[model samples]
Target chain A: MKKILIVATIFFNINLLFAQSSIPSVDVKDINGNIFNTSQISNDGKPIIIDFWSTSCKPCIKELIAIDENYEDWKEETGVKVYAVSIDNTRSVNRVAPLVNGKGWEFEILLDVNSDFKRAMNVVNIPHRFLLDGNGKVVWQHTSYAEGDEEELYELVKKLAAGESLEEKH
Target chain B: MKKIILLFTILAFTFSSLQSQNADLGQIHGNFQMDAQLYNNDSLIGANVPSEKMGLNSYANFNYTRGKFNAGIRYEGYFPALNGFDAKNNGVGIPYKYASYTSEDLTVTVGNFYEQFGNGLVLRVYEDKALDYDYALEGVKLNYKPYKGVYIKAVYGKQRYYWNTGTGLVRGIDGEFAINDIIEKLADKKTKLTLGGSFVSKYQADKDPIYKLPENVGASAARINLYRGKFSLTGEYAYKINDPSGVNDKIYKPGEALIVNATYSQKGLGIYASAKRVDNMSFQSDRNADGKDLNINSLPDITKTHSYALLAMYPYAIQPNGEIGFQAEVIYKIKKKSLLGGKYGTTIDVNYSRVHNIQETQINDTIAIGESGSLGYNSNFFEFSKEVFFSDLNIEISRKFNKKVKATVVYQNLVFNNSVFNNGNYHKTIYSDVAIADITYKFTSRKALRTEMQWLRTNQDKGEWGMLMLEYSMPHWFFSVWDMYNYGNPEENKQVHYYYGAVGYINKANRIQIGYGRQREGVICAGGVCRYVPASNGLSVSITSSF
Candidate 1:
């Protein structure tokens, strides 16, 4: 039975070569404990930034704070939406909402307690950022963060919102 | 061997089809990481002399995804492993691989997988590389959601132990239901409720001569979550049947755990409180395994996780056998224009946590507190013991002085029972006060400098210590230097200076860092899980890239 299933899976995946890049339809929970499908995330043709973070990661917190400090300017310049995904697991999941509320960050916070979405996205480290185009295709991705990394991210967001291809320069 | 050939064949066929079709071909993405260290002996700080004098750990992951189908594999290598890592990890190959398919209402996964059920009180399969821990289950898993707001998951597997599977088999199932979503009328209401339950069991052959042990150990948990506007409460209760294991000294004692959390938050203020009690709740896949090995469940710690070097010197380690703990925190932001707020407003956070040994009474006058082949001990579920294991109170304040300057200050008071947590000869309690100040100044839009000064005062363990760190960063490059000095040790010869320097470069999706440092022997912790890091003088290099 297992061999048959493996063969069947291989055949099905072979035909999937022509599929477009779309967000994985994994289930994630909001701060209020409501489940939502990742494929349903849309901002009406605006580009989106998904940040993978955890409560214990200092670099991740620093990156999010930097983005938060300049969030209004980025939104005003380009129709960009930032979603902060917390992969805190059960060990630190309880502290996530309080931390987000305390920081006064205006980004949508999603909980990936089991890291389903993180594993699906192949994120190996905290502070991993994914830039999704208006059509929900991932156009650019970066890992790690320094002091001035948010500016680079904002520039890409502007280019993406303007319907420019990221593959050329970035 | 056959599986490897099959995997390669599939990959080759997939790529060939992609080239011929000239289609989207889905996506193939992965990441690579390598950490190498050259060690030197330092007798003063008890640094061990490694026979190899160097170690390397590396891994490369490849993931392929196409709509509803996905597959991945991780290849790992450890040349004699790191100095402090388990020697058993000296060699490695493909420790993790998985294939999965998902539809609108159902998902199926085979091969190696990681999973958790209901806050992981009952079961969890995960990997933490820093701890040299990877217990991914070689398993079959299924997730079925027949209706809105309902989720059901089933898993059967044997955990991975080094290059081989553990001696025990694990099986579990979980179900969750959201009341508001399940009932249409309540969907639009403000209040929401979720209920969940799980049952997990592990089977191992009993081969002890002194006592009779159960072959199948079972654990179950029930949880509830309620949310209304800005207030929310969540709780879970778990129970296990009598199971003898090494951690509990082979005692046939039933285990129990309860965790409750409540929170209320608004725009500029957040409040949270949580309490937990665990009694003899150490569940493991292998009955004889100990430490961070072959664990099937996770016990949440109530202590606040500190990020500062000095503040984290003495971290809390969960005593899974029996512990009762509680934590409370409040975060408030002062209005911008107020006197204490300054121009950009100030935020303050206050947190406190405490844990104690659970009250236990001996079964008989001479049986002692816990004995083998016994029920361990009897105790009142809500009783608190007079002995305190750990306590901490901390406060932090942050403010932006100007567009170019920002500062943060923190103070912490901690009481750690070294005798209980460390299990060493020093049986005295440690009382310490730590202070930290962090300041950052942006030289320009693309340049910045940050500094951290920390002081820890304690007369018990290592005495008073001080640390200073300075960092300079540009758009893609960063350099840092730090030194920690233990100046007040009673034994003058033991006082040492631990210094470190590092440089890093980051590109689009890649980073490389190199550092030379004298590390102080201490406990490093992540989410209350503590590991002892041996002192060492070493040069380390790390590289990470994703594509």
Candidate 2:
């Protein structure tokens, strides 16, 4: 069984090369304590960036701040939207609202205390990011972030906003 | 031999079978990871060289979903297990597999599943790969949303014990209701209210020949939440019947716990505070299992989880036997262009927490308190023992100096009772003051350099220490080096330096990192669970990806 799973891993990787998947519908919570569905996440026919973060994850905080520093300009220029998702469990779930409010980040915040949405996205680590086009189709994704990785991400966002995404052309 | 050949043949067949499907049929997705290490000897650090000379651990999960039906399986493989991992994990098998169906507001699942109720006082099923902890229940689960604001769930299963399942039978039911969502008149009100409750029970056959034990144990918890304007408050209380397990010294003591927290958050500032009390709250599926097996509940600690390497060395371990604690924190952002805030802005964070043993008294003078087969001891709910377990005071300030530079400074004071962990050494308390300076310089839009300087001053245990780290990162690649020096050892020749270097590459959802270094022996924790890593010198490689 283990050997078969190895081959399955390779097979899935290969199959994903030509795959285009939309977001999965999973139950999560908004900052207001409302149960929201992931399928409702949209940017009014514009680009969207979904970020997974936690309070204890330093790199996740860095990446969010790095983007927040220029979020206004990015939103005004491209009409792009960013959704910061907190994966803090019950131990720190209450801290999410306060920290986000204190930081004054101008983005939607969702709480995934049970990690349901994270498991649906096949995300294994924090600082994981996903870029979706106007059609709600995932165009690009990354698992880890360095100090300057946001620059590369912004370039992708620019290309995507210009109607250069593969799905958009189709 | 023949078994290997058979497995490979099946692998190829399964791959082709899956590849033949068209995109319109359904969706397939999952992730995979592999970690391998090469070990070496180092006497100074007391590193041990295993006979295998190497270790390899890997696993993969595949899930298929089509409309309302979903299914998945996970396979794990270990080559004689890692140095610190349990020997029982040396085999290969599929320990997790499940299928579920959902229609409208109702869903049903069979096989392995993870869950948690309220504050997890009565039940919680979870897994942490880094900590080698998974209590996934193999059973049947049901979830239903009968009304607008009403939700209910029920579970019946046995706990997963490594490759097999525990013999005990466990069952639970949980229900939650949102008053604002259900009521038409209060829907638009600013004040919101929610209430929840859970009941969990376990049954094990009594096979002990010496003393009669309870064949059935039950526990329950109740929770409430209120939100108004910028303030929110939550409270949860849990209780358990008499459960004389291996961890509680065979005392027939009922368990109970209470947790309460309040938060006031608004634009530019946030404040949070909470307190908790636990007494004899150890509930496990197996009466004789010790350590991390078959645990049915987890306690939340009133402390912060630090990410800094040095600061994480002395984390507080939650005491399930009995404990009392409180925590408070404030986050404030200095306005931009202010005297203290640069052109951008400054963020200040202050956090403090302390924990201690609960006060306990004898039932009577005739019998010594906590005697075997007795009702244990009595305690005042509002009192705490003089012996302090842990305390921490920390503050952090972050600011962007300019367009090309950013900096953060942190200072902390910590006190840890090492005696609890040192087999009652009596006077092994450790007190330390830590300071750290972190700076990042952006050379270009796609390139950056980061550095950190950390110092820890102490007069106990291993004494003072210093650490330095440097990293250079590009758009897709990164290189980093770090070193930790124990410079103030009581014994002159025992002082040593631990260093490590790594190079990693990241492209989209795929990553590979290679490193060679010396690992320090310490405890790594997530939530309330923890794992101990032994000191070793070695080279390691890891690869991970998701699709």
Candidate 3:
């Protein structure tokens, strides 16, 4: 009845949106305790990869370690930047800085204490990753990490860097 | 046929009108997840098939964002619910919906939202689906940034209790000020500070037959933070007025809590210390609700969350009535080419934590310690009780060997109090030791194999246990199998093995996994929150997608 029509109208509107989308704006903080917007996640026309993680997720640490081991080469070859965002709450948020420094990860770090950015991105799982093209359009996205998954991530970065289409637009 | 035609006509008309007005049609983003399980009767583990042969739980969310306005709706369904979840989640419905708009310095949200104020000491409205706990407030929330470095918010709503809202009305407001951000001169200084405070209260009609209960209860908290070069400190204290509730044995004692943490970090080295003391600090929106229902705030955990199967067997449940705990951790990395560190270097992590019951004495000679309708007890702010609740000490070492192999080893010793978690069934204290080893071998740039071995030795409770697992993964697929063996059970016939296997596929932002296993009864905890799950033999399948 009435509910059916309401759901239908919204469904149609969503289906009609086909253009490439850019990152949504949401408030987040840097490790230095500065509040900023997610739209500021930029690489100056270079490619960018954003990884959502938490302090207690074991798989996330493993993936980040692997990426760090190969980050220098990736930067030199593709000019791709990495931003690792921690979705820790107020209490655990303090651990993010120490953990990152202890692990010696050189990627840019952002803290999403209330998970505002995570909710905006519709990310339900940690280690959810997204690769944006030079235009800030999310050209590729992934969830979960297997042992060699970073290599596949690099493949998509290589294409996006070369101005190639990910063919992920739906 | 008529519905389809109307749907298309309305779609076409709205699409054309909206398309002609704005260049950006806005963006639609959402995520969906479904988990279903088919159960079987297994006598060995006390698992019995439910009347429903199968159980399914699913949730989907759709969010639309256009410029400064965004709206979303979440639909959750649990067909008779899974074995572990409460029976209340047996129907299907739209449990969450919201619309919000943001202006320069103000944002308004209506319908439903989640919020937290200053370490969540007094107020934190949130949802954690895995634990089947969601307290999403259904009402209005307003946020205002009146100044450069000041943020204030107010909320009024009733907590969602399963399919409906709770009987109580909840309201709260919070504000925070960043001194350095507000004062331009202090922006560039070496030190920084922030101050925050919150006040929250709940109201419900009192209709008790035997006792007179307070219809309105209020709680408040204040916090401060400090940051300097390579070091940071944070502390929060909360206090609540006298109130009687079902969870606290109906005692009319005021509540109080204190939490403090400090940390210092440098390259390849990190040190942390934290302490918390909670005494009758449980605050619930509903005066007579079940345990953990309609909770107004989240109590922070001062212990680490272990990922190992054996080490996490007996998890810590927050002692809402009264307890004190402390934790310390250090992480350091060894230089490459050093004697202890191989060619690729090594990382070592050490952590320790302990919890003790808070000392309590009689309020007077006329009343019992925890008698209903009486002042619970008198507790000194810094006194330690004679009984120990829990303790753990663990260390981990991770290293890389060549370009294809990486490994990690960990050892832990822990003590658990059975009386606390078992509802006073047995007050025996149990001690256990655990060891785990994980290794991975890369076959190519996109292929790898991993293995894990874990063992736990103990002289109490279930005695000893062992586990082994092996997994293989490619760029888009993974397969794994493992088994937990309780081989040292006191009764020979009770020794049993809980084995499980799973295979999964991942493509871009979509994943599907299927698993079959004999799950052992245990509690799963995250951030000090816990959920009890029963042992079962079942085939489980799950699918998750995000766009």
Q: What is the C-alpha RMSD of each candidate to the true structure, in Å?
A: 5.6, 4.6, 3.4
How many steric clashes does model 2 contain? 0
- How large is the interface RMSD of candidate 1? 7.7
Please, what are the lDDT tens digits per residue for candidate 2 over residues B235-286?
8999999888788877888999999989998888999999999999988999
Candidate 2 chain B: minimum summed lDDT over ten consecutive residues — where? B16-25
Per-model TM-score on C-alpha atoms: 0.94, 0.93, 0.95
* Positional deviation of residue B407's Cα in model 2 after best superposition, in angstroms: 1.1
TM-score (C-alpha) between model 2 and the true structure:
0.93
lDDT tens per residue, model 3, B38-137: 9999999988788998889999999998888999999999987888899898999998999999998999999988888888878888888888889889
Model 3 chain B lowest lDDT segment of ten: B1-10
lDDT of 1: 0.88
On TM-score, the candidate that comes out on top is: 3
Q: Candidate 2: give the clashing pairs.
A: none
By DockQ, the candidates rank as 3, 2, 1
- The candidates' DockQ values read 0.30, 0.41, 0.43
lDDT of 3 at B330: 89
Candidate 3, position B390, lDDT: 89
Clashes of each: 0, 0, 0
